[model samples]
Target: MTSAPPLAPSFDAARALRQARETFDIEAAAVAGLKNRLTDAFSRSVQLMLEVRGRVVVMGMGKSGHIGRKIAATLASTGTPAMFVHPGEASHGDLGMIQVNDVVVAISNSGESGEITVLLPVLKRQGVPLIAITGGLQSTLARHATEVLDGGVDKEACPLNLAPTASTTAQLALGDALAVALLDARGFKAEDFARSHPGGALGRKLLTHVSDVMRSGEDVPRVAPDTAFGDMMREMSAKGGITAVVDAHQQVLGVFTDGDLRRLIENGIDLRTKCAKDVMHLRPRSIRPDALAVDAAELMEEHRITCVLVVESDGSLVGMVHIGDLMRAKVI
Candidate 1:
């Protein structure tokens, strides 16, 4: 028998790109479907959540279990304390973790899992509210649930239409929707998130204070505006900062620095005979003492300055901030 011709090597980059784009487009279309369908089911889900006296219990199997863990984590970090419980484990005696006041959030793409189906009755008997996140609106799990959240995708991104791709993406986006809605309803603030993420860079940025970093009192270099340029140099050098604030009536009139002295010399000004006001940088950039350290950093960058005078709201000089202070705080 004649052998079939060897299969040709299909070399089509455009075909691969088209397939990749199709997957993302399918997921996008599925998530977009959830935007206009805020039904009584969604309201009941939120209401049951609000009324519960205990934490939310998230459960799923397979790929949904992975998504459930992430959803639980996001909800926990955003003001709703929740934990993932594997339905398979629950049948193996983990269901005892479910309290009478807790709410059960069961996630299954098809709304039917042998493990999850086995535990539905026990949860119902315990009077735990069951919130189902599933792809099918008429599945047995949806019918058994106290509230059903539909995350149905028109089709799977898998070439065989078998793998959980677009459906799982839709489930995650809906899970995030629930978390963000609850977060805003609870008046969750940036500071609240910072408390939960204290080791993160954002926590450091939001919680940092001016008093924690500013050079206060005598450590902040200051001198009278009428002080001679020669005397100002001594003050600036003794303080070890780049500049000295020239104060008049307790408010900064300008600043004199090593740079200013160099400019003064190059400009033919007699250093010993000139006053600080005559050669100082007039009306220099300053920040309020109560401003966030990050805001101070921004002002420093915007003006291309290495240091700034910390002033009171009434314009009186209070302290100083430097690039070094921001770097030490690890906020730069």
Candidate 2:
């Protein structure tokens, strides 16, 4: 018989919980320490980035490289033009991606990654400003950088204290601080952020105006208030489920929906001769054409209605937006 496989270690729930809590406490303390360390150098780094004619080129090695990628993405999304460049890749041929007008943010806990140190001279030669984020004040990266933002941690959360834990946490927090500071300095607005993030729900809420999604012109089922109930039913059928009861000037007097028809039929009203004004819902909910699609959704949900009239400033009906349209536009 083959030798039996070694037994796995027994599970220890208490030990696992203790270890997780210890890790969280250590990382939290590391991030908290950064508050006292924000110095004039941090401000200068933000100014340097603001003045950069080109992108912020972030570089690091190993774990720092991973954190650097996230920092670059945060910077880019928050109005700063930033990209991550692996130091090893820089030596191979990617250094060409960096330009003299760009600001380079070099991250290294020890500040002695050979891959990054090796490219320092090249960056210097190109006149690129270097901002260093490192755990050591006297590290090689700190010495060569134009500005230094200390990302030091008291100790690692790792049991062996060898794996990067608290140090990376501090670095990531510092990177976020930098991105937010730059965003504020640039006066970046919510609409600007929405423009960059147009694929998500938040973007739709901010960027989609009512006119863009509302059914307008002839597609809007509009009937005069004096219209006979038979003609009103035809208008509702042709327009889907509802019709705008308006005057000759296209000013919405009221709205007639399928629900209203059901109530009328239940009240034993004769559909053949009665007029739309006799059974229309007066003071129906209306939204301006310039309002956000999200606003329309809110109104529909609040009133428990399926559609709302889009009107101009003068109370004239301009369009109609249905719940189905909002759903198709992913605004609901």
- Against the true structure, what is each candidate's TM-score? 0.82, 0.93
Output the lDDT of residue 17, model 2: 100
Clashing pairs in 1: none
Tens digit of per-residue lDDT, candidate 1, span 1-332: 99999997987999889999999898888889877665778877877776678999999899999999999999998889899999999998899999998999999988878999988888888888899999878988999998999888889999999999988898899889889878878889998998888777887788776666889888888888687766777888888645555555678777876666677679886667877677777778888877788888999899887888888888788889888998999877
lDDT of 2 by residue, 1-332 (tens): 89999997999999999999999999999999999988999999999999999999999899999999999999999999999999998999999999999999999999999999999998999899999999988988999999999999999999999999999999999999999999999999999999999998889989998999999999999899788888988999999889988998999899989998889889897878788898898988999999999999999999899999999999999999999999999987
In candidate 1, stretches whose alpha carbon ends up further than 4 angstroms from where it belongs are: 1-12, 36-38, 216-219, 223-231, 238-241, 245-254, 273-284, 311-318
lDDT for every model? 0.84, 0.94
Residue range with the least summed lDDT across 10 consecutive positions in model 1? 240-249
